[model samples]
Target chain A: MTLAASPHHILTVTVENKPGVLSRVAGLFSRRAFNIVSLAVSPTDDERFSRMTIVVDAESAPLEQVVKQLNKLIPVIKITEVPPAEGVERELMLVIVKAAAETRGQVTELTAIFEAKIVDVGYDAMTIMVVGEPEKLDAFSDLVKPFGIVELQRTGRIALPKLARESTRLRSVKTARA
Target chain B: MKLTGAQALIKSLEMEQVEVMFGLPGGAILPVYDPLIDSSIRHILVRHEQGAGHMASGYAHATGRPGVAMVTSGPAATNIVTPLCDAYMDSIPVVVITGQVAYSVIGTDAFQEADTVGITMPVTKHNWLISDAQDIPRVVREAFHVATTGRPGPVLIDLPKDVANAPMEWYWPEKVDMPGYKPNVKGHPRQIKDAAKLINEARRPVIYAGGGIMLANASNELRALAELTGLPAVTTLMGRGALPDEHPLCLGMPGMHGNFTAVTAMQKADLLITLGARFDDRVTGKVSTFAPDAKVIHVDIDPAELGKVRLADVPIVGDLRTVIDEMIKALKSERSKQDPPDLAPWLATIHDWQERYPLKYRQEEGGPLKPQFVIESLRDNTPDDCILVSGVGQHQMWASQLWKFKLPNTWVNSGGLGTMGYAVPAAVGAKVGRPDRMVWAIDGDGCFQMTAQELVTAASERIPVKIAILNNAYLGMVRQWQELFYEERYSEVYLSPDLPDYVKWAEAMGCVGMRVDTADDVVATIEKANEIDDRPVVIDFRTDWREKVYPMVAAGSSNDDIILGPEFGEGGR
Candidate 1:
């Protein structure tokens, strides 16, 4: 079987919500020399479990090896890979761009075009809260860079498997039966 | 049910049926020692924490039980890191307990405090830092369960001093609640069938048995499979005793220092039915050229090891014993449907290779004692079931090459990590674990110097483990490499023959010590050392330093390029 050619592989891992569990997962990646492109972790629906969204650079280590090694950790419950094409991924970025009176209208127009919200407005700067797919967020960041961004931060990325779609033929068959 | 955490910890050990533990007490662990005073479990106080860790590993290797070791935090904890790493690499089930500073002072760098959990996280299968006194029994249970299951490995439990001193209601944990830690013990039916189909189809199939066979107690299953198919088998270094060395189909060890036949069998095989063995670089030299045309059927308990190196055509994740049993049944059904492949030609080829490049050495009369000759003599003199342990170096290679291991759990050494100074303490623990069997540690002078002080513990405890030091007056393996690879520059590898005076050191440690310089005295000294049963014995054998382990595939070189000793004449290449 051929290895996944994608440089970035996103993995959703559920682990026991115990102290040091995060370090255990993080330690494993660092020691095994698997480069983590981005990581976002938070409590899951069940308080006893936590979900970790880890995006790893597959060029440094094979995705199969990374998953297998992570599974070996006692605290890790389940690991599911969310391929870029098969999953819904979102990233939130908060940027304080230099929006003077002249460029304020342009910044607000740009934010509206990107469907971003101005969470905090300063005398000379505006903190724009933009939430979208990582790629869209990257495009927005590039569009706002010309307005002289003062500070920027992205909340990494969180993902979930896309809902399964009903086949059109099956739907048509159900409709005919109805 | 009210008890201090120390008492609960000792009670937990008793519940686990732990017979003995190796450790030394310190201020942080003093409370734990108090409970040990009234405990039934025997605690063998060691000279150093490193000794304790290795002793625990040796016990595990010898008895097939998770070995127990306890040490204080900070320096003491750091001292045992080598053994923990060694056990991790070799997959020995060792449960180490370390005393930590008070929970409140843990980050304050209190006296004798260390982040034991953080330090050992990468090396252990799992580790815990117990904060609540009530968590003692469950954590202990989990530690043992994790350490002994799946691919067996070392685990640690760091108990804070305050926690150990705190009062707690003790109750035995009937079952472990590790939701995420379930080890797959049985093979998938499809994988098993696929493996059997490959086994039945290949004429040049080699049963590459590894340490997993012994760890899973599947030597009988291995023997059954090898006999059923008439397939030749090669055991790796860690897999030394999995198949009896004298078996007709056994091709001895296969690796960098492996025998010519074993190395060549793997290189020329059409199918490699690898069990419980990883495709380590040492075994498959320059993997790109290893078994160029072979289809691998890799079986291991750990799914991670399946495709870690060479991808397997059939990768079965299960305990070796269970997987092999399934494979045997599957093969029987397959064989009944179609005739088994004719392996006579393959066997004949292996036999020819074995005869042409048999392991050879020369020991002239009155000449300096050859290390291989000493190992052979020991093999001849020792009991059939004696447990032989060795430290890392040329002596370890020589011992692995020369000794005819006939029983499982009879050969122990630092195979993966190649830790020096493993022999003395490990032999002591092995003897303690198997009091019925004779335990001999074959050590090098350099290795002996590392942990030879453990002899004092053996002497004081009256554990009659025998040791034979192949004192070659140099770090022999490194010296050999310098000689061959560096134009004989001979840097800092030499350790003068009589510098520490091993005999005097042994006597000072309260043990009988003997020295043999000539070939004639070798057997006599060994025999005499064997007769002593009251206390530990150390025999210093001044061996010839010029000899090198042969049939070597140099680092990163292909197995096809195995270098034989001069005994092979012009065919040495």
Candidate 2:
């Protein structure tokens, strides 16, 4: 498959839970001039392994080249590309907006529409916790920019492959029977 | 039985059958040095850590085995960085062991503490910083395995001082179970079939061989395929000896300074069967215009190398030996159905190019010595099986162009990295690897000055490697570039011929030194140097500085724009 078709590529990399693995992976990206748009890492259910959700800008480097180079690292166990359409992805963002008394009502209504939670209330600002796909988070941030975001933190992205649909499973079963 | 981590490290190396290692001791690595006195592996103390690293690379290049190098941390670790990068670029197998500060003081910036692994992450194939003393054996085993497998590059192991001194039970791991590291050794059957079909259909085909053939020890298979299909092959600088120079189908080295026939053949071929050779910029010139008409069947062990610079019609990722064998069988089966394309016309075209623009030079009797003539004399006088190592420069290009390499593993140089000062130490390492074979390091005066101190190590270790310095008294390649492209604006290229008196320097280092200034003395000096067996010999051949390597493709230009030398009449295009 041609990897240059998409600008954004999400790779779920499984690596050994050894020391300096994160640095090695990050160093590889910087060394090869591959732009890492977003990256999140956490230990897997198996203590010996860790899973890294890496979102890369494919325009900076070809996705196939990035994947092949990552696979060569001895600590990396496996790399699976999670296509945006075929995978379920989420990002967590905490934004403190300038919601003074005059704009507090409007900000509350906007948060309700997006189903975001107001985790903290302050004199001049409200801290909103928004968890959704990267695209949804971007939309929320753009809308809140008029309210003046005082502080912002995005927990980059984490993803998993979507479950197969029941209809697709049924069709596969029928084909096997045939 | 319990043993120190350093002892376990030594024992593990012995288990891996490492006979010799090049290194020097320092404070951080002092613990590891203590056990070396009892170890069976012979350690050659080097004048510099860079020398140790290059020596290891030389040994690996000469013997086709992973070379070992050890050094202390901080500056020592940093010193070997060039060789590590060089090995990585050229896919040479070398395992470098660097001592680190004690585990407790690792982050405190204690004396002789540097993050060796972090600094070398991009250059090495793999690396490990030992955290536990008990993990020494497994890490050593993994380092050796990773360094020797797949594309085979340098690997590093940073051993902390505390870990080296800590107690641990030594047990050699029977099997390495690295889930992330499995090298594919067999080509897919379908890809093999497609490659064979392409081979059978092509009219003008050239076998583009590279260092990977020698790394895979598949030279025999390459020769078999070339002979079977009656195809002409062009070897890159790294692949010089993969196809013997005397072989009828061998078209010699092809690149910026390659012969006219080899470069033009690639530029004009209809198909290129690329075997273990990457489309390096030097060999390809301007990538967009490289072999514009040819369909490439690229095979490499590294998957990333395929479709990297140029797209391959059929990209086969596997070991070259197995892939070539499968291709041979597949070609034979396909031939049963239809005959291969006739290549007589293509062969004749290449022959004409070879005849019209062969590598040429001029040297009058009793006049100034020419570097090319000196190389020819050395090649004629040296043993047929001698291993010729070289530092990077005009001297290196001349050696690659002029030497008649008839065997694999005989021609060694820093091709991908173009590292200067690689010869003298590498020669010592090469001689150590194969003492029975004569090792000659052809170096330039500028290159010789960079690491000439390594001759002391060679002399002290009794390595009888001979060195022939093409003393042109300039950074010859750069000066040539300045002369041609920069309009004779020679800036900082000249190194005077009389600086430091090479004969006296060689004598001080306990080596037999000789000098030759005229054409008549070239062969006699080389013969006399070749006769020395007890110690190292250094021959300084003062040659004319005006000569430049020809059949040149100016950087960033098309290979079609190659300029033959002045011998080819005015404007020699």
Which one wins on DockQ? 1
How well is each residue in B406-473 modelled by candidate 2, as lDDT tens digits?
89999889998989999998999999999999999999999999999999999998999999999988
Model 1, B363: alpha-carbon shift in Å?
1.1
Total residue pair clashes for candidate 2: 0
Chain A TM-score of each candidate structure, as shown:
0.91, 0.89
RMSD of each: 2.4, 2.6
Instruction: Give me the runs in candidate 2 sitting further than 4 Å from their true place.
Output: A1-6, A167-178
Give the least accurate 10-residue stretch of model 2 chain A, judged by summed lDDT: A1-10
- Give the CA lDDT, 0 to 100, for residue B550 in model 1: 92
Quote the chain B TM-score of every prediction.
0.99, 0.99
